[model samples]
Target: MRNHTALTTFILLGLTQDPQLQIFLFIFLFTTYILSITGNLTIITLTIVDLHLKTPMYFFLQNFSFLEISFTTACVPRFLYSISTGDRTISYNACAIQLFFTDLFGVTEFFLLAIMSYDRYVAICKPLHYMTIMNNKVCQNMILCCWTASLVVIVPPLCLGLNLEFCDTNIIDHFLCDANPILKISCSDTWLIEQMVIGSAVLTFITTLLCVALSYIYIIRTITRFPSAQQKKKAFSTCSSHVIVVSITYGSCIFIYVKPSAKEDMTINKSVSVLISSISPMLNPFIYTLRNKQVKQAFNDTVKKLVFLLKK
Candidate 1:
């Protein structure tokens, strides 16, 4: 076992090692990071200030918006810094901290989405009981559970990763120090730790996915029974947005993490992983607001109010 003091830092290779590509990559990612933050923040502000958006669905959307902010902040800023300063190296402690929070936020988001799905399911399937069931207290509890679950899922791997000896290469191929990427560089026997990480990740992912699937199934069944054409149309519009976000986020995550690590195809795999972490956060708010009539009206109203205030 090596002394803890000996292993102090790790180097992140970032998106590319090519100097020429670095400039272009930096410009592209910086623009993306700014847009993502701006878009998500706008959604959060709109959701909070607009009384019309105080419903259960938008309430969850607010939480999702906040999560997206935290999620991207975990990784994107660092990448930008690396691009600007040409310092892609991350300290071992910083890398571990980044990994922990990335996993924590990512997993929390999965559960949050699951809760939102259930909320929608109730709203559509059991309209009469939606308010009673998804009351403020219940919503708070669900949010608390999402945070708590994220903590539990992240702590064990974080502790284990911290203790391991990284006496070998410190260079991480991916832009971030994700569990799998970091584990690859450890000099210690990481088999058990790897298995534990995989098992924990898969368990949470599958369980949350099952909840989302079941809720949507019930929602679809209920939608089919709606007597009014308008009601059916409304349900489809709302549900389709949720389904799109869910499919993209979960689909990308599962594709990246669940498969066997293809060391030979690191470029494609890393790109896909980065796509999920970076792009998905920005997409959530747009998908929900653009697709829902209520949200669109609320947003337009808010914009008008803002413009009027600014003119004054």
Candidate 2:
């Protein structure tokens, strides 16, 4: 029974033990991280620079992009650094820091998705009131409230690790510091913490998901009522990307965290975590922007500006 201070540095087992695979992983993940940053940055830039995108939807889109960037930046860079250097030791404080930001960004994202769904609902179902409902102040307040709520929600379970005495078993069998992996390494009884974390995840998912589902239910019902097929198709087209992103993000989150035990098989869990922390961020920008004519036009406009500047 000792303080966590004595066990300051814990060894991260990372995703693989093979030296050859580690190098290969470094290359793959490094590229993914770069792409994630660039893609998210493009979204933010377009949202900021394009006057046509000055709607509540794009406002929330930019915020979501920022979260994706921050989310991956928190975990992937550290994971890449550890894998590349073959030095997998992380300080207790650093590990805790990573877990905190990961949890923060995750819950915030949940709320943002719900908000995004509601924005779509207002736009489609109550078009006349959309502007009134999602004004700038209203949007800002919603984000602030969600972030604050996330902070409050995580405190009860986060204390589990904050007060832990990690005197034994310094090996974390994952690529980065996360709640489950950190709890697995602790010598203390983690049953309560595990329960709380799982509970929080499930509860949050159900509530926020319900909001999104209801929004969609109303949205779909209203779309079906549209007088013309083309009008209904246009509405669905606008929403399809959001639904895809939400389904992937929410589905992956539930699979990773809804388990009874945090100590799920390391191999599978690490792969899942990589998908969430590394691949998802990169995937989101593409999902939102690939077929988006507005974004393509924005990109072309920006390029022309750059070319014109060089000529000067």
Candidate 3:
């Protein structure tokens, strides 16, 4: 076994090594980070303050927005700093913490999205029983379950990664200490580690995908039963936004994690990973608010109330 005590830090070969490209990246990602934080916070705030948004859907949305904020915060700030200062090194401890929390939040968000889909499914498909089915108690339990599952699923592998000695190259190819990149740098034979990671990933992917798929199946079937053109249109519109968001998030995740490894695949994989991590947060607010008339109105009302209070 390698001497773990000797290694103090690991270098991160972030998105790009080019100085000029770094400047461009700093500008672009900084903007994205700001927007993601702002948009998600706004959604959470509106959901909390608006009486109309007190329903189960918005309740889950509030949690999703909070998770997005945390997910983005875990990596984007460090990435932006690295790009600007040209410091691509993270302490070993910091990297492990980052890796743990990133996976924790990411996995939590995946389950949260599934929960949201279930909320939508209940609301759209079983409107009469929606309130009875997804009451405050149920909502709280679901959120708790999502968070608990994330922590449980992430902790063991993270502990394993932390225990492994890093005696080889200390430089991670990606911006963050993602499991794949971190495993590559370990001096130990990571075959078992690799298998563990793949197993965990496959399990998560299958479970989340199944939940989303089943929710959509029921949603589609429910929507088809609507006889009126207006009812059909409204149902379709409501479900379409959720479907798109779920598809994009789940599709990109599957592609990046499950594909055959290749040299050329790295660029696209990194790009897609960045897109899913960075851009998806911004999309949640837009998707939830823009697609639903009630949410938009509540958001506007909340903003107006804030403005009026400021004026007062």
* Candidate 3 lDDT (Cα, 0 to 1): 0.81
- Number of colliding residue pairs in model 2: 0
> Candidate order by TM-score, highest to lowest?
2, 1, 3
Candidate 3's error at 269, in angstroms? Answer: 2.5
Candidate 2 differs from the real structure by a C-alpha RMSD in angstroms, to one decimal, of: 1.5
| Candidate that beats the other on lDDT, 2 or 3, i.e. the better one | 2
lDDT of 3 by residue, 1-312 (tens): 124467878898887878788888888888888889988998888888888888988788788889889988997899888877778899878887888888889888789888988888998988999999999999999999998998888877776766677765787788887877777667776776677776777788889888988998998898888889899899888777678877888888888776432222366667877887788887878887778898889877877888999999
- When summed lDDT is taken over every stretch of 10 residues in candidate 3, the lowest stretch is 258-267
Model 1, total clashes: 1
Please give, for residues 1-312, the per-residue lDDT of candidate 1 as tens digits.
133548676788877878889888887777777878988898888889999888888888889889899989998889889888988888767886788788888899999999999988898888899899999999999999999988888788677766777665778888888877777767778777777777777988899999999998898888889999998998888888888988998888887777554233457778986687678877777787778888889888988998999999
TM-score of each: 0.95, 0.96, 0.94
Off by over 4 Å in 2: 1-5
Ranked candidates, highest lDDT first: 2, 1, 3
Which window of 10 residues has the lowest lDDT sum in candidate 1? 259-268
TM-score-wise, the better of 2 and 3 is 2
Q: What is the C-alpha lDDT of each candidate?
A: 0.82, 0.88, 0.81
Better of 1 and 3 by lDDT: 1
